[model samples]
Target: MVLANIQQGEKESLRSYTNRFFAAAAEMEDVNPTVAIPNYRRGLISGDLSKSLQLVKPKSFPELMARASQFMLLEDTGNGAPDV
Candidate 1:
């Protein structure tokens, strides 16, 4: 399954990966949470989002996306902060 095999590129932003992921998912007839959940989690880079997902697994796809969205927001904001 293309969706199952999708991996976050080394330099890809969380936003970009999410867009790509959804695009692949859109082509599928139906996405099973059992597959989507693990695939999505597995595809994330080993960072805050990945760590969070590992620590507290999302029970559903919606829940997984919500957490990813939160981390994406944090990542975006963190990138804009001025380093002391």
Candidate 2:
């Protein structure tokens, strides 16, 4: 729907759709630790940062920390260099 709205030159509609998607995401009551963290990350990258933070905050701090640590090594090689 977002892509369709964009293709149709409906910028306002696209924004509304994006906001709706974020709102729906926010209303999720529960989610898997592994899946939810990644879902939140994707939301952040896609302009739903508040929603991402919402998902992150309800999780155990240690779990969040573990995800953060894993994020740091997502593209690790023996070269000991940053992926990005």
RMSD (Cα, Å) for all candidates, in order, is 4.4, 12.0
Query: Largest TM-score belongs to which candidate?
Result: 1
For all predicted structures, in order, the TM-scores are 0.84, 0.24
Best by lDDT: 1
Q: Per-residue lDDT for 1-84 in model 1, tens only? A: 488789999999898998789788878988887778788878988877777777788888788788878877877887531221
Model 1: CA > 4 A from native? 79-84
Worst 10 residues of 1 by lDDT: 75-84
Residue pairs with backbone atoms closer than 3 Å in model 1 (clashes): none
lDDT of the candidates, in the order given: 0.80, 0.39
